[model samples]
Target: MIRITFPDGSVREYEAGVTGFQIAESISPALARSVVSCGVNGETVELNRPIEADARIALYKFDDEQGKHTFWHTSAHLLAEALQELYPGIQFGFGPAVENGFFYDVLLPNGEMIKEGDFKKIEDKMIELARKNEVVVRQEISKADCLAQFGAAGQTYKCEHIEQDLADGSITTYTQGNFTDLCKGPHLVSTGDIKAIKLTAIAGAFWRGDATKDQMQRLYGISFPKKKMLDEYLLMLEEAKKRDHRKIGKEMELFMFSERVGKGLPIWLPKGTDLRIRLQDMLRKIQKTFGYQEVITPHIGSKNLYVTSGHYAHYGKDSFQPIHTPEEDEEYMLKPMNCPHHCEVFAWKPRSYKDLPFRCAEFGTVYRYEKSGELHGFTRVRSFTQDDAHIFCRQDQVKDEFLRVLSIIQTVFTIFGFGEDQVEFQISLRDPEDKEKYIGSDEVWASAEQAIIDACKEKGIKARCELGEAAFYGPKLDCMVKDAIGRRWQLGTIQVDYNLPERFNLEYTAEDNSKRRPVMIHRAPFGSLERFTAVLIEHTAGHFPLWLAPEQVAILPISEKYNSYALEVANYFDTVGVRATVDNRNEKIGRKIRDNELKRVPYMVIVGEKEAAEGTVAMRQQGGGDQAVMPKEAFAERILGEVAEMLKATNLKPEN
Candidate 1:
């Protein structure tokens, strides 16, 4: 017997060759029925894969993210199997499960193409195969044998991939029914688990994402264990379209991208700028309370700066080429990160232990050479400003500083209506097996990873650990918030680094007057202003909170005579720090109300004969229902009071 530890810290004695499915069966039949996959010592694996030694295990159901990944991974194989039968000689490129669902790239035989009308046929075929309850079999094969099999089958892409990418010992494949594909997978036990299927879309993708390679037809699809779940997902997709930030941004005149100006560069209009500035101001106020000193950094930096920080080695290809100079042969590039520049700032001064915790914040704009095909609205822009900050502190101070950052993140999320239940934390650690993908010594990396774990434990925060997802330099705590529609978005990050100080040779005098390197804490409550704004737009559906709304109130005139009173009410609101706009257009009050409602203004005040003479206004709330008549002064005070309450900050200081 071997000891198998469960996630709840319970250990059970089991036979050495017990499979995950057998282990689940031992616990409960219901659990065995629902469990789609299991994690063995942090590695997700097939349920039937035997555990030959003592291991830590966690069972996953379809509702769990890991379980969904395993489910969709098998569905991708199922898709390939269906396509293989439907379109003989169709060569496959790559098929993988993504955050939403799965997609497979394939070159159809004889220049054939698949279109929207073909989606149903393909989906029906997938369902037909899924009903067979075919068990997926994972096999390890030699590279030569893999190449021979795929090559014999006329799959040039798979052969080429095997020749160029796969090593002899590491090649693996998953076979289900009539189809087999090159894959490394943790798949569902059987195809019958997939009760519902949908082929979402078809797009063209260059083989391996290289623009120069042959473009193949990419089929996007999603599968669910329950038919009802697929129906709900379809409904969510419709709601997502309605809440799309790009569409709402245009209607609200928030932000836009101009083709002539270049793609992936968002230009904030007046309203967007207003909202962004307010967001900055709000963070600045909270930052000030935490003793943070804000700084401004340039948009370009010397190439050597990044080389010294090791960012060039890790992300050079993702950044624009270095800009050459006419004189001195010096090379500069658009800033891809703010940490290196901030490192220079830390090195600028000699410090003692009293000044160990040096915190600097910047709303620094950075650029990346994102592939044109990968760019999305503000969420995936090429140029964006990060609310970045770095804290240099002693080893003992790391936990305190981390908790403080957590407090700020929690405060910000709460103010934006994200509750504790809606937010989840992830501890991203470097992969132990793949050391070359990261920097720093194993000892330092281990310490940094443990610090985050201990901090979260002390704070009583439950965070899921994900291997190989850390920053190249260190481990990080990432915050993902579920939106109103239950879609998770990564918005905040806090990283602990011991490598940068050593790289930059930064030092501070300790209590014994000895030189010591201070630890570095990198954090961004709002990962980037652009991405956060996009999420906010979708989360609130363009109906922003009064405190953050660019135009909190729209003052409409009933007629030409009341236009003056509209402006008067606007002026009064401005004095009281309320964002009020006068809609003194030639259109009637009904049209004006309709337009402002579409803009999602929180309040609308109608200025007519009685209001102009009585110094009062008739008020109507957005989406109707809340109607009242109040003096302009009373309305201003009410708006201001509500905003003040909403803007209230959480406790800035937490116990160490």
Candidate 2:
């Protein structure tokens, strides 16, 4: 008998060689039917794989992330099988499941192409193959045999991958029906589990993402176990198109990109700058209350600095080439990160243990090199500013600092209307098996990881732990916020690091008068200003809150005669700290109101013959119809009062 441990700490005695399917069957018939995969000792695997010894196991249903990965992986294989039947001599490159769906790159024979019109036929073929319910078989093969099999099948791409990337004993293949490809899979039991199919797009992709390699057709697809689920996903995709940030940003003139300036470099328009400044001021006010001292760093830094901090080793390839100076051996690079410079700031002066928790904040801009194809508006940019801060504290104070940072993140999200239910926390740690990928000793890594875990526990924050997702220096807690459309966006991060301090040789005098290394906590409530603004634009559909809106009020004069009165109202609003713009164009009253409404101005004040003479204005809400006419001073007070109320509701003191 073998001991099997479940997630809830329940143990069961099972005969050796019992499969995960059998284990699920022992629990319940319904569970066995619903389970798509199983996790053995934290590794997801096929349900039919035999468990030969005592292990910890978890059965995964379709709702679980592991189960979806397994399901989509199998669906990718099913797609290849369908293509083999419909288009002979199709060669496969790589097929993997991504966050949304699956994509497979392939070289088509005879210069044939897959078009949008062919999507329906391809999806039909996939569904037909799926109904066969063919079992997927996983096989381990020697490199010689693996190459021979794909070589005989005329799959040159597979042969090349085997030669360059695969080892003799580390090769695996999955076969389902007529299709066999290179894979190390944790796949679903059979193709029947994929009941619905959609072929989303076809794009040109170079083999292995290398520009020098042959371009292949990449087919993107999605599958679901239920037809209704696929229907809902299609509906969500439609909604996403309507909420695309790039589209809204252009319409609202929030930000722009110029080919002449450069791709992936965003230039904030006048209104966008106004909105961004407000965002910065709001965070600055909150940081002040938390004892954070703001600082600024240069846009370029010595490459040696990053080399010492280990960022050069990790991100150097992705960063722009270093700038060479007239002086020999002197080089600088556009700042790829702000932490290393902040480390220098801490090392600039001597300190005692009393100054241990030194908090420094910066809205620092950094630049990186991104492939043109990979850049997306503000979300993926070449240059962006981080609302970054570092806390240098004693090892014992790590947890307390984490709690404080979490409070700030929570406050920021709450102000943006992201409730607790809409947010998720992920604890990302290093992968023990891949020690080469991360810096620092195992002891320091463990301590830092444990501190974050303990902090989350004390805060009553339930976070999912993911291995191999940590920064090269240390573990981190990341925040993922689901927007109004239910799409998740990563917005905030807090990392605990002990490695950078040691690298920089930063120290402070201890209570016993001996030198001690201070632990470092890296945090950013808004991971980057550009990315955060993009997500906010999409989340709110470009309709910002009154306090954050670029143009809070639009004053429209009913006629050319009332233009002076409109300017007077705008002047009065400016005195009262209300951001108002006068629309004094020669258009009619209705046209002016419609234009301002489309601009997403929160309030529009109409100054007509009666209002100009009465020294009052007619107020109309953005989406709401006309509110009652009120005196100019009363209107200004009302706007300020509304803004104050929003801040008060969030438990934040409004800044003057």
Candidate 3:
């Protein structure tokens, strides 16, 4: 008998070689039926895998993320089987489960092609295969045998993958019916478990993700055990399409992209620029209250700067190629990060313990060379501004500084109406086995990691820890916010670093009169101005808050006759620090209102003969029905009052 420990710390004696499925059965019939996978010790494994020694186990159900991943991974194999049946001689590449679904990359034989129109046929074939309920069999194979089998079958992609990527002693494959593929799987027991499937989209992806390699057709799809769940997922996807920021940004004329300017570089139009400036001002004010000193840095830095900071070692390949100087052998790179420049700033001035926690902030625009296929509107642009700040402090001050950064993130989220439940914190730590890849001594890494964990504990913040997710120089805390459509986007980040200071040889005279390295904390409440705005555009569906709205109010004249009164109303709003515009074109009131509403202006104030004579304005809230008419001053004051209340609640006392 061996000891098995449950997550709750309860231990039980079990016979050696007992499978996880048996353990689940021992717990309860309901649990056994619901469990899709199990965690043996810390690794996720199939329920059918036998355990022969003492272990810690956690059974996973559909509600758990790991279980969902396992389900989707099996769905990918099922998809491949369906495709092979429908299209013979279909060579396959990697087909892994993604955040939402699964995608299979394939190379069709005889010049065959797959497109969106073929989704229905593939979906039908998948359902037919799923109903057969074929059991998935897992097998461990020798690298040589795996390559030989795939090569004989004319699967050059599989043969290449096995021969190059797989070690001789570490190779596995899964077979379901006549379809077999190389995989490291914790798959569901049978294909029939996938009751519903929907093929989402088809795109071109490079084989092995190398741009120079042959491009394969990638098909994206999702599966569910129930038809109703699939329907709901489809509905959410439809809603997502409607709320796509790219479509809304173009329709509202907020931002644009020019091929002549660049592919991934976004150009802020007049309205977008106005909105962006407002957001920057808001963040600037917030940072001032937190004692962050604003600074500016050059857009280009010497390649040696990044090399010393350890960023070039990690991001150099993907970044824009170095620019050679006209003079001697000097090369500069477009800045990929602001931390390196900030490190230089910290090193510029010697300090005592009194200057321990110096904070510097910048709206720094950085450039990186992302693959052309990966670029998306404003969200994934190559050139973007980071709402960046770095804090240089003593080791003892690390926890307090992290708490303050957390407070800033919480405050920003609250002001934006995101609740605690709508956001998640992820603590990313370095990989222990890959020590050479990361900077800093083990002692410093431990202290920084512990400080973050303790800080979150003290704040009562629930977070998940992810290994191998840290920056090359340090551990990090990331904030992911889920939008209205249930799509999660990374919005903020905080990193603790002991490596940069060491690299730069930055130090401060301690209270004991000894030189000590000051720990660096890198944070950004809004990860990037461009990406945040894109998320905001999608989350609110372009209906920005009154304080941040590009145009808070639109003064719509009932007719050209009341244009003067409309201008007066607009001027009044301007004086009150409210953005407003007058629509005096020859258009009907209904048309003007509709147009402004589509623009997502928060309020529409109409002026006509009666309003002009009475010196009042008619109001209609965006998405809200017509509000009662009121004096122009009363309306402006009401809007200002609401903004003040929100700011006050958030404790955002931006510096004048």
**Could you give the candidate ranking by lDDT, starting with the highest?**
1, 2, 3
Assess every candidate by TM-score. Answer: 0.98, 0.97, 0.95
Error of 2 at 530 (Å): 1.3
Query: lDDT of each structure?
Result: 0.92, 0.92, 0.89
**128-183, model 1: which lDDT tens digit per residue?**
99999998899999988998999899899999999999989998989889788899
**On residues 14-85, what C-alpha lDDT tens digit does candidate 2 reach at each position?**
999999999999999999999999998878899999999999999999887788899999999898888888
Best prediction by TM-score: 1
List where candidate 3 sits over 4 angstroms from the true fold.
Answer: 1-13, 653-656
Where's the lowest-lDDT run of ten residues in candidate 1?
A: 647-656
* Clash totals in order: 0, 0, 0
RMSD per prediction, one decimal?
2.4, 1.6, 2.1
lDDT score at residue 316, model 3, on the 0-100 scale? 92
Candidate 2 residue spans exceeding 4 A from truth: none
Ten consecutive residues with minimal summed lDDT in candidate 3? 647-656
